[model samples]
Target chain A: MIELQHVTKVYPSSPRPALDDVSMQIDKGEFVFLIGSSGSGKSTFLRLLLKEDSPTKGVIKVNDKTLNTMSKWQVPKLRRTMGCVFQDFRLLTNKTVAENVAFALEVINKPQRTIKRVVPEVLEMVGLDGKENRLPGELSGGEQQRVAIARAFVNRPLVLLADEPTGNLDPETSQDIMLLLERINRTGTTVVMATHDYHIVDSMRRRVIELNDGILSRDQSRGVYGLGR
Target chain B: MRVNFVLSEVAAGLRRNLTMTVAMILTTGISLGLMGTGLLIANMIGDMREIYYDKIQVSIYLADGITDPQRDAIAAQLDSSPEVKDYLYESKADAYARFTQQFQEQPALIANTPQDALPESFRVELVNPQRYPVIAEQFPNGQNGVDEVRDEGDFLDRLFSLLNGARNATIAVAVVQALAALLLISNTIQLAAFNRRNETNIMRLVGASRWYTQLPFILEAALAGLIGALLAIGGLVLTKILFVDKTLAGPIKAGIIPPVDWSAIAAISPVIAAAGVGLAAVAAYVTLRLYVRL
Candidate 1:
């Protein structure tokens, strides 16, 4: 479902490349953990996958389409097929939980009937059915993360790229988010999550790709974090 | 993408930046008002030119005790001149009667004037009003029966030039104010975008197109512009009713200045509205393109 061949990304005014000649592949329906410390090119990897920024060299193919050759107008269409969740949860603070989930569908121009039917079902799946009208500020951190996950999954995207989904949560709350993500993965949504949380990484034995100094150092099946880095 | 969603977002954004929105509306209103005033002045100048240019005349006053033969000779010269299109010889009694009629509203001034105090003159319309110097050269002042040759067109020229200068000054000030209004609109749009950056970022991630995220800010600017245009039109209407119609009634009634009718205001109303909305929307779009990421 995803392939990167010798991708190199060098930002202007920076001494070194953000990602240097990195190549990797992930099959469909795989829950992969991208383990790296800060400035280790984890976020850069996800950004390239989303086509938010083009690689300086080499090629990236997501779902059989070469991202490097895609036109600018097609970028939004490509992103519509994949959902993204950030470390900050990125919820519209003024909106209620249900409105936040519906926002994703609305952005894609979904019909009102579809948005009405899908929003509630996704909220139910994420365990936020009853708190539809509660704003993000009124919700707990765990609940807010659940809203973000609901928003990501509302459209039933092919792949979910999460950048430190539980970075701001407590340890117990982080486990709940991990379990929710794992549940989403089991339902045939490929998940690529970047994180520095070792406990959640070790608890879930999945395909792990580790980055060190802009290079792919390890790729292991049924892997744990901090074992090869 | 959805119209309702875009509209709701616009409403929310306007509410969030209510003060800035109001400021933008008032600024746009003042700018558009000045522009409308400039346009009205230009139209009035055109009308006044049409009315006055055709009526411009040069009056050649006679000496106090000029003989009939000298008056006849002057008349013969005026009739033979190619520059004179037409001429009216006003006797002293005729001049005094015209003076009384002109100052009828000021009875006291008319009463103070003697019956024969006004001079007998030849009111000559030139083939081209600009050929006044030619007539003055033909009949020199203090020669023949000509006491002094007065070109009314010259005074009208100076008056119209002063009016034109005032019109140009008004338009220049209006241009500067419009520029300030555009800058304020750009700043307001930037602030609105910054305040909602988090929402915009999420929209971008959730597959909203850049245009979809930008629609709300653009719509907010357009809405303010629309309101400002309506206010400016209202201001113009009020000025016409309270100031022009009421305060300047005497001059308009006496035909000193042309009346600004409803049709004239109607002619420029759509232009003002279009300018207000179009300028504000363009400014907002440019600001977003140049400064805001989304």
Candidate 2:
């Protein structure tokens, strides 16, 4: 679960707050789409959730732990319970697909035996089974995204935060990634995705929270991306 | 954390930054080599001081044409003095014979020296060598049977001072080289971190702690330092064998200067290794804290 109450983020030397007086709640195992245009506080929202940036004046509770009050040494522990995916697919270019997925578990100090076993299973789940030895540079964009997804899911984190996971993919590949994400959400891991993909947002009927000019404009159950301010 | 995994990462990092790694190692080796040389010089100075200072003697030269009774009176005065630990009276003939024996290798010099040229004196060893002034005052110049009182300890003082200056100079240069080595280590670590920025970014994103991300880089520096220390020790051994032992063979054989032995090198090897590893690791750690985020 994630909760943000009266959250406002202001960047120094900027005239306005990035996220102004924002409040939201998402329960366990819900797939929430955060729809916003560029510079509409979507990235700032995700960064606040990840504790990468502190809220200027707000309280953020993730999994019942108040993030604003947490010490720096506890940040890594908080992050270990969550997974993150990026727009660029953020795979290590030099590592093989399997190694890339295993890297997630390795960082969490997983045993070698568990990494050896789970890496293949996650690769299989993401449909990257046969490309285990291929580097990210050698893989297609869609396949690379799958590797990134596999890496994110390898630890079975309680929450998954994706920032434009399919931003660089074609429409067809983007649909496939959405389906994969939907399947992952069904397995009881809460998923929060920030995106500007109108077509994908319109097709995937889910709980949508729309942001416009640093304000929450709409929160709808079973929503679609509407063309409205 | 698995040490094997960390070690593998360290190996990969070093391999990627091979040129920088080599540069760091050579700089560290040279620096530690100079440091070890300085330490060995200090030890050599200590040995030389013990060798020379223990044998220091003061000579009370009798004036020419002195009577036997005056000489006997001076000898009686020396016998009663507590400052004289022991005295050997060398007559002119005995002094000349000893001089000839010393210059036996130079036949021309030995042949030109006459029998009465050398002085007859009391070669007096003091109970405490530093009490030369007491002996000088007891047998003053222009006194009965006294010409001059010469203390070998004064010349030893000047000699040791020169050796101390050389030792201090070597240590000073070593300190400068050590500073250069530290800077090189810092730069090399920064470069290595920059090269592996992508990997480190992913590691940080994947729940790796800051220390976990830094471990491999630190290990790489430490390994380079370890290799550098070994090389420095080897350099010291080679110098002892090829330079000191060979060049100073005659003096060492004659016991004029102490030979730099294996025990002295053994004593300093650990200190050099510790300095190498400690300095390199500290430099890398500080660079990471200040420059690289991780």
Candidate 3:
């Protein structure tokens, strides 16, 4: 669950604010999408949600913890409960698919037994079962994305924040990935996906929040991502 | 939390940056080896000084045809001299007897010689042979038929000065090389860190602890240093045993130059081994401190 109250951010060199007093809330077990154009505040909103950058003005809460006021020391602990996927898969090229997923557990100092057990199941669930031994280079773009998904899910984090999860995949592959994300959401983990993909946004008819030039322009339940001039 | 996991990561990291690891090893090895040389030379100088000061006895050859009154005056002067530990006056007859005994192979020559042909001498021992100048100066241009005073310790002083110079030069050279190696290894590790920046980021993102990310790099550098140090230690032993002991030790033992302090060289090997591993770890930690982020 996430809540941003009057959150605003401004970069020193830019006149236009990246997020203009954006206030929104996302509930547990909810599937949501933040849709906008190229310069939309979608990514900025996600960054704030992940606590990667502090907001200039206001409070943002995730899992009942107010991130805006949390000290630097507490940020990593906050992130432990959330899974994040980037536009670029961000896989370590040197690590195999299993290692990439195992990386998540490793950071948490998970036991080898847990890693050996969970890594394969997560890989299998994301359709990368036998390919665990293969490196990222050996996998296709879609499979690489699947590996990323498995890594995100392996920790069984409370929330999943994705910034363009399927931007590089074909539409059909995108649907398959979205279906996987939807299945994960059904398992009671919150999902906040930020994207410029109109079709998937329109097709899902999930709770939608649209941002335009750093302003939250729409909030609708079971909504399509259409709110143009 | 797991030491083995940290070690495995370290092993993998070392494997990843093989060239940098090797460079760190060589840098540490060369620095420590030079340092060991300075230490060994300094110790050897100390040993030489010890032996020379302890064993060098002064010889005072008495003048021929000296009367008992002259001997009495010499004995009076010797008794008051601060340099003398103990001195015994050997008569001409006693000198001839000693010569005959020492040169037993030529007993006939000694049996035919008259006592007057041998000179009366004072066999003098000093309080400290290093204070040889004290007694040697006493009999200079002999006032009481004291022919000459001799102490062999002056030669050791010259040798000590030479070794001291060598030790100082080795220390200076080692310091310069140590700094240069530090800079070079720092750059190498920096480049290696840059190459793995993404991996570091991912680790940070995944909630890996600071040491979790750094332990591997440090261990890799340490392992490389360990290898280099072992090589240096082996080389040092080989130099001492094969070259120093076998060739130089024999010639020098017969007093051509000076005997090698082999125990000192042997003592240096373990320190070099420890230094090798220490330098590698330090380099790793230092480079990481300057360039890496948790």
Chain A TM-scores, per candidate, are 0.98, 0.98, 0.96
Candidate 1 segments whose C-alpha is farther than 4 A from its true place: B90-105
Highest-TM-score candidate:
1
TM per prediction: 0.92, 0.90, 0.78
Q: State model 3's lDDT.
A: 0.79
The worst-scoring run of ten residues by lDDT in candidate 2 chain B lies at B98-107
Q: Which portions of model 2 show Cα errors greater than 4 Å?
A: A8-16, A211-221, A226-229, B62-72, B82-131
Superposed by TM-score, candidate 2 places the C-alpha of residue B181 at a distance from the truth, in angstroms, of 1.2
Q: Mind giving the per-residue lDDT tens digits that candidate 3 earns over A44-67?
A: 887787777889999999999999
* Each model's lDDT: 0.90, 0.89, 0.79
Where does candidate 1 chain B have its weakest 10-residue lDDT segment?
B248-257
**Against the true two-chain complex, what DockQ does each candidate achieve?**
0.71, 0.66, 0.46
Task: Kindly report the interface RMSD of candidate 2, rounded to 1 decimal.
Answer: 1.2
lDDT of 2 by residue, B1-294 (tens): 868778888998899888888988998999899999989999998998888776657988988877999999988988999888888899999988877765655679878888898889988889988888999998898788788999988888898899889888888888888888889889989998998888888777677888888999888898999899999999999999999989877567657779999999999999999999999999999999999975
Model 3 has a DockQ score of: 0.46
RMSD of each: 2.5, 3.0, 5.9
For model 1, state the Cα shift of residue A1 in Å: 3.3
